[model samples]
Target: MKTHPAAHEPGHSSAPLTGFSQCHLGILSQLQAFEELPALQAAAAQAQTIATHTLALFHDAVYEHHADEERELFPAVLRSARRGEEADFAEAMVRRLTAEHRHIEALWKKLEPAVKAVAKARPVELDLGAVEELVRNYAAHARFEEEHFLPLAETVLRRNGNHMEALGLSLHLRHTPQPIGHI
Candidate 1:
């Protein structure tokens, strides 16, 4: 797939979100796999392998993605909007999206213990419902961001002083060899 020319640079032409978009694909696929896990299996070494990797992904990529959006992307978006109505609109979108993130995280928390047990090659009563819910909600959240928020962000950032460069710089600095997601 030919990515956007700026995909290699943080925040350049939605590069931050471009990477996020890819992560979303992985997350969804993993969630689907989790949904299909043999719930009653006594011992499945392969399940343990998948579970370990899934736990790593949730802890690393998904958590960092939330922090980046909350600390960087959403704020940059709010800054990119004009005062009054535009700002209000951006705030509403951010609120909804942030809420979705929290809800997804909550769903993950519910599933974490069971997944952890599976990771250790132990029997687990994995809540397939929770896994399915996470998959469903996350899918909707990603779709909304891709379909609505990203385009709106690009337009607003481009319109308001061409702030994409500043956002890019901010994101690049955040990911440099340092404590990430630290104030």
Candidate 2:
């Protein structure tokens, strides 16, 4: 994998945030694309491409992105926050965001089989209402983290370079491939 120069540097990486933006935008774009099409038959090249893209996104990147935030970013913020109000706020934010992740994921679980069929260019039973609900929930979740949690995390981590470095490195390492274990 190509590594960014700042991937392990303090205050230099916003990989998690960037990941969130890309995944959400891609998901929303694919869902909206469906709305524009009269029907996404397996026969249409564009429909097939979009369906495949949507399936891969929801199946993989979204889950990994959520895991990255929960495992790396949230802990870093919590570690950096001062005791009392700052710590409490950080904890609360993490709890809310984590819950959001579960809720969104549950929505996806219900919707994934349809997405899978689309990706395979098989007969699809895509439900427009479920798609719309996922779109709305993801948008709101992204907004909350962007407007509230991210700024707070920045404030908490900015005071300590060590904390930022650790967070950055953890994020980088999470994406890095490891050597194969014994078969």
Candidate 3:
């Protein structure tokens, strides 16, 4: 239930590139912590505290980051690609990235309950193999986005001008929390 600093910030108006870079750093740190879990020998309360923080980081930040790409940026990229030499290239990349998202989500599902148990200070067996796989998968995912998807996005969005801003705005709106009474 902790608030993330990046949570309600206006993403499009702000620097999306910097935001993504920061997000990637945060995710890498959290994944490092996750990787360390198997080796941790803390008391129940300490373990629970660590797990709770990890869960919050994933839920609040990492997931939102993913949504920004999937919901806003990816669509913009597709539209921008509709009439370029990069058209087919963009399509293929988006498909690969989307599939990677699914793989990442599936890995999280396998990992969540064990993390939840740790959060509650309950004894639970974690799948170490799954943990290793998730860590490796995320590392690869980050690299792919940073090296491939991002450069392409920058090129396409740059040509489209305001599309980048629109993407930023969409990301900002998506992260902004809705009032409880709002429809």
Candidate 4:
């Protein structure tokens, strides 16, 4: 698949933004695989393997990515907007994205246990419809962030001249693993 031009640009600051886009692409691929694969009832072992890998991808990357945006990026954008010139528009975008995050989290809760069971090779009735809904919602959410939110954030952060560093730092810290005893 062709990567976005922004993804190849030479800049450490853009790494997290590009990574987010790449992550979404990966997630969409996984979702498409899930949607296309035969039901778990038909091929238990293969389905179980796919389920386990997909669940791991979500837990390790997607969930943490969302948390980075919520805990670091969004707040930084809001603060820059509030203090800078784009207060109202940026605030509205942040609110919309945050609400979308909650919706995505709720759908994830509904799907997690079933995925976990399937991953364990246990016989559980999977809600394919809910899975499809989540895929649809997440695709839309990612699109919105990629096309709208991230650009807005970049603009606001750049205009403020300091928030971008903080955004980058927060993203780095979120993705970095802390020592087990450090909490």
Give the best candidate by TM-score: 2
**Candidate 3 at residue 121, lDDT?**
75
* Candidate 1 Cα misplacement greater than 4 A, ranges: 1-43, 160-162, 179-183
Residue pairs that clash (backbone atoms under 3 angstroms), model 4: none
Residue-by-residue lDDT tens digits, candidate 3, 37-81: 766755566778878987997888778778778888888998887
lDDT of 1 by residue, 12-97 (tens): 66667789999999999999988767763534877888899989989989989999999999999998788998889889999999
Candidate that beats the other on lDDT, 2 or 4, i.e. the better one: 2
Per-residue lDDT tens digits for candidate 4, residues 126-146, read 898999999999999999999
TM-score of each candidate?
A: 0.71, 0.73, 0.70, 0.68
Candidate 3 clashing pairs, residues 3+ apart or interchain:
12-168, 12-169
Candidate 1: clashing pairs of residues? none
What's the lDDT of the predicted structure labeled candidate 4?
0.84
Which parts of model 3 have CA positions greater than 4 angstroms off? 1-46, 82-84, 178-183
Worst 10 residues of 1 by lDDT: 36-45
Q: Arrange candidates, best TM-score first.
A: 2, 1, 3, 4
